[model samples]
Target: MKMKKLLISIVILVLLGIASIYIPIPGYMVITPGEMLNTKEMIQVDQGTKSKGDYYITSFEQGPANAISYLFSFTGIIKVEPMPPLDEQKMDVEKGKADLENSKLSAMTAAIRKAGKDVKYEHKGWEVLKDDTKYGIKKGDLLQAIDGISLKSSEEFFLPDLIKYYEKKKVGDTVTYQILRGEETLEVKTKLVEQNGQKIDDLNLRLSVKQKAEFQSPVKVNFKKLDLGGPSAGLMMTLDILDELLPEDLTKGNKIAGTGTISADGKVGIIGGENYKVLSTIDTGVKVFFCPKENAKLAQETVKKYDIKVKVVPVATLDEAVEYLRNMK
Candidate 1:
């Protein structure tokens, strides 16, 4: 009888321990180093040349935190943060997907133009980021027009245009918006608010609907279906596209890794998780890692903190990265 009771107690403890590892604790997320993917395998440019060298994009894993992961955060190898509200999380996921799509488009345009080619773009519509106004506007709604003004135009939408449209109007002015939700087209009314001597509303049209791009060059670029979704790989993808389009070998037969968001005009934007990305390159034979100039300090600090054996190069533009590779010893 004594032996059976002891065995039962041990089993209960074991089951509890396993449960703690698998069950996620709400309101927190765990972030850890992820993978480094070679862009050569991920991107294919038709009518473009293949290079002997390789370009890698770094990534990090994030998910709801479990009890075991929360405990592991103390070791400094991982990070845990309080999760935002559920609605915000959903909005963030949509934004992330949109950003990934935009990144690919921007990379292709930037690379093609840098190679002396032309590319055209059309603004499709506006993506609703917030719907906190008194109106019934909901997040993820496709904003088609405002006060009969079509959002879909040849020119890109800018904040100044939005401001200018509402400039003559005073606070408490109401505007009608035509939005598309699924297959349904609905009209919603929103009221403007005063902020810093400017009249604005929470229509949240800043996040543009995905733009359509047409490349004039014979070279066509397509990305393989990737599990990751974010804009941080934009810079690396642009570099890889350039490598494929140009006759010159940008990699110089060396393994290079990087992370940063690339704009259509070739500017490199800042990204999160630079430190963990640096840690992910350990023992990967990556000679050089490029990051946005804004992240350079933290990336270099992470390299020093972990004694990583890679050089960290900070670049503000695609031209800077190209010039550095051209002059690389």
Candidate 2:
């Protein structure tokens, strides 16, 4: 009788522990390593398309987790969100994200066009809309600053810089911004708030910045929607597009995976979930994983932590990535 009781108790505890991972704490979100999307297959470049080697985009699978997985997240192997992510903060989360995705595809198209032909991609700033926009920011205005810092015209790309400033701020804080409408720059201020312990942008306006791409030999690039949001895939998309547009096989017959947000000038910006993406890339038989130089320390740490056998290459710009792949032997 005593042995049977002990076994039953153990079983009960085990089941309860397993159940903990899925338990939804109100307002909290879960983040886990997501799978690899062989993005090359998803993108169709109009001119020349060839399957030389694999080029992939990786994302982190996010959702509620079990107790075991929850505890493991603390080891830095996985991430958990304390707040509703930016894309999900609004009711039109999918719509907002889709618009952003379109911008990324546009950016990629511009990058490739500039490499192969003469082209310039231009976007002044994200237009501010009144509907559902937080912080009382009016419509038809351009966001030019955050926290009183001006996103000067001389600054490279406003989107990435705009994102960087907002991310540095926490909930319950006050944020001030400079908006541009025509020739006037006006200051707007708002208070920050938290959703499930994650700080959200005070201004929740869906941004579809006005962009114009100029190219003589325009490449009509179409990206298949895989329900993935975020600009992290920009670099890979640019490289893959270049691979197709250029005669030389950029992959050099080896699988390559990368994560970064690309600017019009081809500068690669930092991205989240590099470690998670790298881990998934490792499983995909990729010979090289490109990481943004801006996150050099994290990339180096991830490589050192896992003692990753796969070559981890750090790149600063789209041209740098192209040059490295071009020289691959």
Candidate 3:
């Protein structure tokens, strides 16, 4: 009887182990599809636009091999590009390279203070481009100050108040502002044109924050500071930045699973960690997988081999992602 009982116990243990293979552990979040970015996002400047004699700290290099540089930097990978010094022609051109819309709008209503014309203009915003500018605004000549208020950091201004007040006027309503340009300060007035036939609710206030970086050029990645420890965190970091800035609720409070690098223009770039990240997220029962377009292919193959049931989507930008999340509800 003792021998029979021991054999039965062994058989029961084997069966339990086999059953565990089919059962999935619970996960923490759900993922959905949006866009597919092709490369890892980093910051780089146009050498033609940049001239010698300006103070610049080489913020990032190019490619996965350069991850070490950021590990030792002051802001880690978060502030990859160092602040560059300003010269006359070079400063004007660099400022122009920022978001065109923001520059145009700001030039009309605000005047940035400076010690002199030689002072480098800089501002703190929620999302700054790599080359350093407000994410959505552009650069232009200033004519006046809006509502007698001076513009400081692009990110700190109150936008809703401006929009609400502007709405009361007709298309040709004249608005006056105190303006400064190239060592001269004067009053300038322009007619406000009513923008119609679009669903634009409010002026993108977040666009004025000028500290965001521009990722048009490739900067090197120093990966030691990343908690995820791979290129996958890049895209997620970009999304996190977007979620932090606008009130649109991009993530909708869901757990977002993605892989890519954050670019200065808010574009998602490609990176490694697809297979590993997929497996890790799968084991936790993740609802969605955000990865590169190329890596998504690998993930699909892995899914077929392992018989995965979860959803995996590739993305290219934060805008696409916001749309995807919005449709899920």
Among these predictions, the greatest lDDT belongs to 1
Best by TM-score: 2
TM-score of each: 0.75, 0.76, 0.33
- Give the worst 10-residue stretch by lDDT in candidate 3: 51-60
- Please give, for residues 202-225, the per-residue lDDT of candidate 3 as tens digits: 222111223331222122211122
- How far out, in Å, is residue 299 in model 1? 1.0
The C-alpha local distance difference test score for the whole of candidate 2 amounts to 0.67
lDDT of 1 at 26: 81
In angstroms, give how far residue 43 of model 1 lies from its true place: 1.1
Candidate 2 pairs with clashing backbones? 21-65, 21-66, 21-67, 34-61
Q: Which portions of model 3 show Cα errors greater than 4 Å?
A: 1-230
lDDT per residue (tens digit) for residues 41-99 in model 2: 67888876665798888777766544555677788887655755556565345444644
- Per-residue lDDT tens digits for candidate 1, residues 68-110, read 8888898777998887678656755776777788788878878
Candidate 2 stretches greater than 4 Å from native: 1-22, 25-27, 85-88, 91-99, 102-106, 129-133, 144-176, 180-185, 190-201, 204-217
Better of 2 and 3 by TM-score: 2
What is the Cα root-mean-square deviation between model 1 and the actual structure? 6.7
